[model samples]
Target: MTVVFVLGVLLVFVAIALLAMALRPAEEAEGLNRSLAVIEAIADAPKELRKDLEKPFGERVLEPLQQRALAVGRRISGADAEERIRRSLDLAGNPAGWTVDRVTASKVIGAGIGFSFGLLAGMVLTDALTLRLVIAAVGVVLGFFAPNMYLYQLAYDRTNKLQQELPDAIDLMTISVESGLGFDAAVQQVAHNTQGPLADEFSRMLREMQLGMGRAEALRSLNERVNLDDLKAFVSAMVQADSFGIPIAQVLRVQSSEMRVKRRQRAEEKAQQVPVKITVPLIFFILPTLFIAVLGPAAITIMDNF
Candidate 1:
């Protein structure tokens, strides 16, 4: 009770301090453009404007919590875990501001939430200490793996989108290239005219090249970012074409054809699995319902006669 009281007091004090800082007026802060300076300079700019000038709530508050949790996560996390998380993030297209540290911190946060919930529920539902501890342990395992599972799903969804969009992007680029634009210009055209993960990647690659990175290096990075075999093959072919002076249009046309073929194969594979996927549903749901409907009237009549 004493510890809880003290912690509550500390939380109240921190909340008060945060409110005070938010209300306190700033004075001649630099680095902001003139409009932002004027916005903050106002004695009574709306809360949103001041918010824009200050460190975002996430950065100021959540970031510290994440960092603290990440410290605990790092203590328990193996070196290979971090590497695998980074690779997974790459496969997920590295959503803006996502990092390995954030994911580790999320796992820690999730585990704590699960443990607390499990502990509370166990205490409320039963008096057995052993059972409560078991529940809490299960919670810990589920929470620890939850973030990774979600990240994997995200990567899978993004990769599928990339695959779906690849052939169209390639065709667009081929058209642009054959229309007298150079390879880079054709890529720019595709970026401008289309939209998807693949286009975003092409745009990023263009920007990297514009910033003085070699084409081969930029293309290699793109391949590293995505986890698709078809994309890897296309990148390899593009690199080779660039290196050997093969026409860009020819390379794109061939890749487009291959991508279409792969897309069809994927569709057929998924189609073939439909029956297998439906087996459990049919046994547990549809078949039982049909059997009951077909036999139910006869069974009732026979029971009446008996």
Candidate 2:
């Protein structure tokens, strides 16, 4: 009887331990669910509550912060912004005009957009004060320099367009010269007929020449303003031909043919590069899809059997 009693006691203790283990997880899970529900409630709070939460801590806290931000804007705006941007553009050999009002407006727009995106992203990703502050600082810096970046992009695009149009302009100039027009007349004709950055530049050069600047000086100025190697080469060729009394028509014909050949070779080179560029996407995106298509069903069947 004693042996049976001890055995029954052991079974009871085992049952109790098992019951405790089973209930522990449920209790913990319930607590976790409650915590999560609280968090969701906080997140889904009304817009007014959110605004109140986002408001600056107090008048003492917000006043200084507002003053500092205003100071930053004033410093950035007053630091020779126009001169700096104009010099950078000039160094890039772009003669496009930029206005002070445009620059200021661009900076303001950039700052606003940056601040908004940074604040929204910070709220979405984290609730950490340090991280939010860092994001805001970065946004402010980016915004301060955004106008300069935009101007650089514009200059680069304009330069590229002019480069692409140069060969065609040269070809047309050659045709005009070969048809018995003078070199200056051919350039004027190309400038008048074409509508692009290059044509505009040529038109400017022609105007300078008409205003008593020597042909060579006007062409050199055009070369400097455009800052294109091809234009420089053309200028050098013209200067040498003029000095050596070479036929201008012959010089134009030779340069036009060479330009066309170089253009064709560039096209071929880009075409060849396309296949190599496609290989990376094929390996990363296409191969994985193919593997999934081929092996997925077989793997599923094997797992089911196991």
Candidate 3:
């Protein structure tokens, strides 16, 4: 009995050490902690953590692991995790604008939820301790990566939306310029007249140009922010037109036409892909069901005869 007790104690210590090793990756842990701390420091943090986070934003806002506390604060205050992340990033200097904030928030939330759900699923599906642990580990990994997947999707959607709008915007600008407005004035007019994600971006570009950024530099920054191939091509065309002193209206008209062609090609390509995409479902689902319906009665009849 004494030997068993000693062995049990050793096992407990070993378990604790393993947990520490698994959980204590210093940099990542610190980053999570800092994020929690910053969240708690926000004015709307719950009463309990607010007192703790009352210290200066820079210090307490980046303190140690406070996940439980932050979670509690969130529950009490009803703050959305994504919104909290956006506010935190804004306060921290808004690098990459709201896009970075969205990606970071998604990653943090995805990892936490994924790991928790995965572990819960493992517990429900298996009795083996090793399998459970493996599943939990995989859950954590998948959760951490899930946010990146979402971010990529968001970027792709945003780029596509911008591309879809680009030709229309360019055509509008072309008409405005040809109708007697200066190029800069036409850009500003388009920025004001349209209302969408693309217009928001154009407004920012107009602001930058008005603030004394060179036209080329402003267009480059716009391209970087939008990060769409079509927008980049449009920017390149505009730069060439400006450098060579060509008419802005002609440049806009040509780019607009090219963008329309590209859009048409993309639509055709997606239409062509539908049959290939449908094949997997037909093979796996419909075909199997049809086979079962046709063969099931025949098999049963044969068995009856035998």
Candidate 4:
């Protein structure tokens, strides 16, 4: 049994080493090929066009740094790093120039900055090696995750705005459909009339459909991007209705009604939690201040009498 276990472990280690060796050469060759292509293009281009084809100084300088940082990030990141970051970027409205590569580089840069600052602060505040190491480690962790945290906040705020605007958008669509407009026209109306993430998404969906994509596929893309339960439900209903040849107007009406009800229920749920949320502050802050104010003068007087 021991021999079999030892052999299995050796085999696994050998497999991993072989895979690393195989992949490393491919990555190196890809980088080399890109450099060669750029050199060949530069050599073949006319003088006038060569100036235009040449990259900016900043780009030339940052490209190598970004590659290094990206390497570091990939080493530290999980297998799903690209997809996860892409999904986050989508949820965050896909901010301009914020590609997965840039985000990956930022993670490494952030960690480096964080570690430097943490070590400096630790040196100033303490001499203990263990404490300094702990602080520095904490800084590294925070720095590494800062980009992700920012993305999460952006996604959260955007999702909330989408949820809040959805019911109104649905109502508008329902009215337009009832007034004899086609479903796509109603969606265009929402896209043009409303504003915010929902409007932007609808506009994109319209574009997708106009570019020969199916309505159901466009809607599924929208749903995947938004990550809102209400939006998901609405998309599913619309897809089902389209698939079964049901009336779009009736489907819009049902969704609009449900949106209103759900919005109301969400409001009520938040209202009901107010007291529970306040309890912590009441106990830790307000009650103590009140007791101090009420009892202090009486205690002083009693002390004088005694």
**Candidate 4: 10-residue stretch with minimal lDDT:** 50-59
lDDT (Cα, tens digit) per residue for candidate 3, span 1-306: 999999999999999999998988899889999998887668666777667546766465433323443454345333475565444433232345445434554455666777798889899999998998888888877876674454556666766778788888998898899899988898888889998778878888888988999998989877766667888899999988998999898888888789889989999999999999999999999999999999999999999999
Question: Model-by-model lDDT, in order?
Answer: 0.89, 0.79, 0.76, 0.94
Per-residue error (Å), model 4, residue 241 = 0.8
Candidate 3 segments whose C-alpha is farther than 4 A from its true place: 1-114, 287-306
**TM-score rank, highest first?**
4, 1, 2, 3
- Residue-by-residue lDDT tens digits, candidate 2, 1-306: 999999999999999999988778777989999999998987999988778566767565745654555555556676786676555565354544555544555566568778888877877888998898778777867986786887677667877787689899989999899888999899999989999888888888899988999988887777766656777888889888988999999998888888788779879999999999999999999999999999999999999999
Q: Candidate 4, residue 296: CA error in Å?
A: 1.5
RMSD list, candidates in order: 12.7, 18.5, 15.4, 17.5
Query: What digit string (tens of lDDT, one per residue) describes model 1 on residues 169-280?
Result: 8888888888899989988988888888888999999999999999999999999999988889999999999999998888888888888888899999999999999999
Q: What is the number of residue pairs that collide in model 2?
A: 0
Q: Model 2 segments beyond 4 Å from truth?
A: 1-84, 87-97, 112-120, 304-306
User: What are the runs in model 4 whose C-alpha is more than 4 Å off?
Assistant: 1-64
Count clashes in each candidate, considering only residues at least 3 apart in sequence or on different chains. 0, 0, 1, 0
Whose TM-score is greatest here? 4
Error of 3 at 69 (Å): 11
